[model samples]
Target chain A: MTGQDFPEPGPFATLSGAEVDLGRLRLRLVAEAERESLLDVVYRTVDAPVGRLLLAATRRGLVRVAYEVEGHDTVLATLAERISPRILKAGGRLDTVAGQLDDYFSRARSGFEVDLDLRLASRFRLTVLEHLREIPYGSTASYAAVAALAGSPRAVRAVGTACATNPLPIVVPCHRVVRSDGGIGRYVGGDDAKRALLRLEGAI
Target chain B: MGREPFEVVVERYGPMVLRVCWAVVGPTLAEDAWSETFLAALRAYPQLAPDSNVEAWLVTIARNKAIDQLRAQSRRPAPTERLPESIRWEEPDAGLDLWDALRRLPRKQRETVAYHYLAGLPYPEVARLLGGNPASARRAGADGIASLRNMLAPSAREKGPR
Candidate 1:
C-alpha cells in the first residue's frame, strides 16, 4: 500500500562535476527525483491490478491510462493536479472494455467497441485518435496514413507525435500504426512492448 | 513467539528468497511473497521441526503463497493492460539466454527449475516444498533441466567452449 513496497530506480554515486562537492549536490537531486518517481509508481499501483500504467501530459491536456491496474487514486491525483478534478475511475464503464480486451488477447475479438473520454485532448489529437481508431483489428497503418486520415496528409510527424503521446494504446489501437518502411516505430512504452502488442494482434 | 526482525531475515537471505519467488511467480509478485514468506516463517519458526531444513521450509511457504496468488489472478480474468506498475517487476535475469526460452513451460516445470536450479534446492527438498512426492520433484527437476539443456545447447554450442 505504501510507495516503499515498489522498487524505485536505485541510487548511484557518480563521479561528475568539476568540483567534487558539486557532485554531492547532483547526487542528492538524483536521489530525490528517484524517490519521487518511485513514489509515483507505488501510488499509481495501489488500486491497479498488475500491469502497465501510463501517465501522459500534452501541451494542452493530460491523460492517465491504467492498464490492468487496481487503484485509481494515484492516476486520479496526477490528472487532478495537471488537468481537472473531474477524474472518474471508469471501472464500471470500463467493464465492457475489459471484456473486449480479454477477447482480443484470446484472439476472439477483433475490434474495440468502447466510448472513450477524449475531451482531455485538443481538436487535432482528438481527430487523430478517431482516425487511428479506424485502422482496423489485426492490421496496422503508418503514421502517414493516420495523418492523411486526420485531414493533413503532410502531417506524418504530427501523427507520430500524437501516437507517442497517446494515453491509451490497445483501446485506441495505436499498435496498428507502423513505420512507412515496414518497421515498428518507437512507442512511448518501448518498442518491444509495441512489438508484443502487434504480435498479439497478429499484425506482424 | 513473535515476528523475527525483518531486517535480519532480509539481510540474511533476501536475494535467495527473492530468487525462489521470482522463479515460481516472476518478479511481479515476488515482493509480496517475500515479505509474507518471512512473516510466515517467523510465525512457524517456533514450531519448526529441529531437523528440517529452514530454507526448504521457507521455500515451501513462498511456493504456496505464489501459487495462491496466480490462482487468484486467474479467477479475476480482467484485462492485464491496466495492471499497476508496482506489481510488475522487470523480467528476471536468469543469467542465461535459455531463460527466455523457458517462457513456454507449464507453470509446474517453471517452478521446478526455479526451485531446483535457480533457487539451488535439492530435488527432494523441492518436492517437499511443492507438496509432491520426492520422485515427482526429482522428475520435474530432471525434466525441466533436460528441456532447458535441449533448448539451450545449440546456443551454448554456438558460443563454442566457454
Candidate 2:
C-alpha cells in the first residue's frame, strides 16, 4: 500500500479519544475498589439538617468538611490541587466518621472523637482551630477570645481569617466562635448552619 | 525527591493503557484489564522509581492484566450454544470496529502494532514488551498495519476522509 493509504494522522487518533473516555468510566469502578488502599484522599457526602456535607479524609484523619454552599466540586478540585491529587469518592474509609456525624447531627453526640488531619491548615490557622475545639459543646466564644486562647490577643481579625478558612468546620466546632457583639458571625457552613448546630447543642 | 500526585499519572497514561488493553484483549474484557492495571499501578505508584518511563510501566501492567483475563477465560468451561451478551461488541461507535480487525492479527503482530501504533511506544520498547529485538518488532508492526490497511481500505474510501 502507498504511504497515502495510511491516511494522514489516520483512524487511530480518533479511536484513542473514544477509548480514553471509555477508560475513564472504567477507571471509576477501579477507583472505587482501590480507594481505601490507593487514593490519597477519600471523600463521601452525607445529608444533614444544614445541607449536604462533603467529608474528605487523608490516611492521617478527616481533612475537610465542606457545606453544599461551598460547591463540592470546587472544594474537591482545590483539595486535588493543594493536597494530593489521588482523590476518589468512596465512603468505606469514612464509616466511623459518617456514624459520628450522624450522631452529632441527630443531637445524640456532644463531641467528636475522630482524629483530625489538620495539615491543610497553616500554623496560625491551626492554632485558631485548636482553640475552636475548646469553645465547649453548648457555648460560644468571641473571635477575640479565640485569638487570646490561640496566644495572640491582638490577632482577632486573624482569628476570623482562620475561622473563614477552617478546613474541618463542623467537626472542629468553628460554629461556636461568634462575634463579640452577641451577633452570630459568618460560618464556613453559613450562619444558618452555625445556628442549626448551636440550637442542636441547646446553646441557642 | 517529591512525587507527583497519582492523579497526574492516571490522567496521562490512562488512554494509552486502555488502547493497549483493547488491542490485546479486544472489547469484551478490555475495560476490565484496563481497570485492574490502573488499580495495581496506583497501589505501587509511590514506590516507583522517579526516572521510570511511566507510560511503558502502565502498558506492561495492562499487558499482564489482559493475559490474566485471557488465562481465566481459557480455564472457564466451554459455553453452551447460546453466547453471552457481554461477549458481543455492541458497536458503540464506528471506530470501535477497529477491535475486530485487530483480533484478526497474529498475537505478536497484534502486540507489536498495539505497543507501537496505538500506545505510540518506540520499536525498542515494544520489542522489550513482546520479548524480541527492535528490528523484528518493527517488521511485525509494519506487517500488521499493512494488513489492516488492506482490510480497512474500502471502508475508509466509503467513509470519505473522517
Candidate 3:
C-alpha cells in the first residue's frame, strides 16, 4: 500500500494514541509484579552520604547494597545471573529498607531495622557476614577479630575476602571491619565509600 | 559483550511488545500476554546473543505468548457478552474501534501487520517469526493495511476535522 492509502498519522500512531505511554505501562507492570510477589529481584538507587548506593531486595529481605564504583548495571546483571533472571527496577518493594537507610544516613538512626537476605553468601562467608552485622554501628573490628568471631581464627584472610564480597555492605556494616593496624582497610565499596560510611557512623 | 540487565530489555521493548500483544489478543488478554512474554524473555535473556535484534526477539516472544493466550481462550467456554469491568485502552475515543478492526483481520494478516508495522520489524524478520517467505509476509502486511484503511475510511470522513 502506498503512503497516501494509509491514515495521515499511520495506523501504528493512531493505535498508540496520546494516553498509552508505554513507560507508564512498564512501571505499572513492575508494580503489579511487586504486589503479586512475582518480582524475584527489585532494586532502586539511593543517594546516601557515601554517593549513590544500589539497593536490591528479594521478597526474603534486603539482599545487596552496591556502590557506584561497583557499576550499578554490572551489579544488576550479576544479580540476574545468580538469582532468578526476573529482575525489575521497582522501588515500591524497597520502601521499608530505603526508609531505614535514609534514617541511618542522616544519623537519625544508629542501626538498620530491615531484614537481611544473605542468600547470596554461604558457609564461612555466611558466618563472616553474620559476624559483620554484630560489629555495632559505631565500633570497628579488625579482620582478625572478625575471623575469630566467625569461629575460624586463622581465616583472617577469608574474613577480608568476606568483607570485600559482602553483599549488603552498609546495612550489614562491612565498613566496620578494619585493619589490625587500626587503619581503615580495602572495601567492596572502595576505600572512599568505606571511609564515608565510617565517618557517618562516627567510627572514624 | 556481556548481556545487559533484563530491566533494560523490558524498558526498551515494552511498548512494542504491548502493542503487538494488544493487536494479536485484544485488550482483555493483552496484559496477561505482555506479562508472560517479558517474564519468559527475562528467563531466557542471558542465553540471548548480545548482538541479537532485541526488538525482533521481543516481538517473537510476544507472538508466542499471544498465541498461547488465544489457545487458552478458545478452550474456555464462551460467556455471554457483557461490558468489561476494566478496559485498559488509555484512549477510549478511537483505540477500541481500531482494536475491533484489527481483531477482524485474517490471523496471518493481523500477525504480519502487527509485527511489521507496529513492532517495526522488516518483512524478512516478520516472516521469520510468522513463517512463510518475506514476499508473502509483505503481501499480507499490505493487504492488512488496505483492510484497515477501508474499515476506518467511513469513520474518518464522518468525524471530519478531529
Predicted model with the maximum lDDT: 3
- Residue A122 Cα positional deviation in candidate 1, in Å, after optimal superposition: 1.0
Q: What TM-score does candidate 3 get on C-alpha atoms?
A: 0.76
First chain of candidate 1, TM-score: 0.62
Colliding pairs, model 3: none
* lDDT tens digits, residue span A13-46, model 3: 6665534455555676786666666688889998
Q: Supply candidate 1's per-residue lDDT for B80.
A: 34
lDDT of 2 by residue, A1-204 (tens): 334223233535445555246444544754554644567887889998898899998888999999999998788878877776667666766889989989988888989899899998989998899878888899999999998999999999999999999999888988898899999999888888888888999888
Estimate TM-scores for all models.
0.38, 0.65, 0.76
The Cα error of candidate 1 at residue B47, in Å, is 56
User: What pairs collide in candidate 2?
Assistant: none
lDDT of 1 by residue, B1-162 (tens): 222322233345545666566556553555556656655554455456545665677777888888886777678864332211222223322222333445556767878777766555776666766778877876776677666566556566467443
lDDT (10s digit) by residue, model 1, range A1-204: 233222121110010100112222223322433333311111112121224453332222223454433234444544544443222221323445556666776778887666555655567777898888888777889888899889999988888888876766667777789999998898755777678778886789
How displaced is residue B127 in candidate 1, in Å? 64
The candidate, 2 or 3, that scores higher on DockQ is 3
In candidate 1 the C-alpha lDDT for residue B69 amounts to 69
| Model 2: residues with Cα > 4 Å off, grouped in runs | A1-37, B1-19, B26-32, B43-101, B112-162
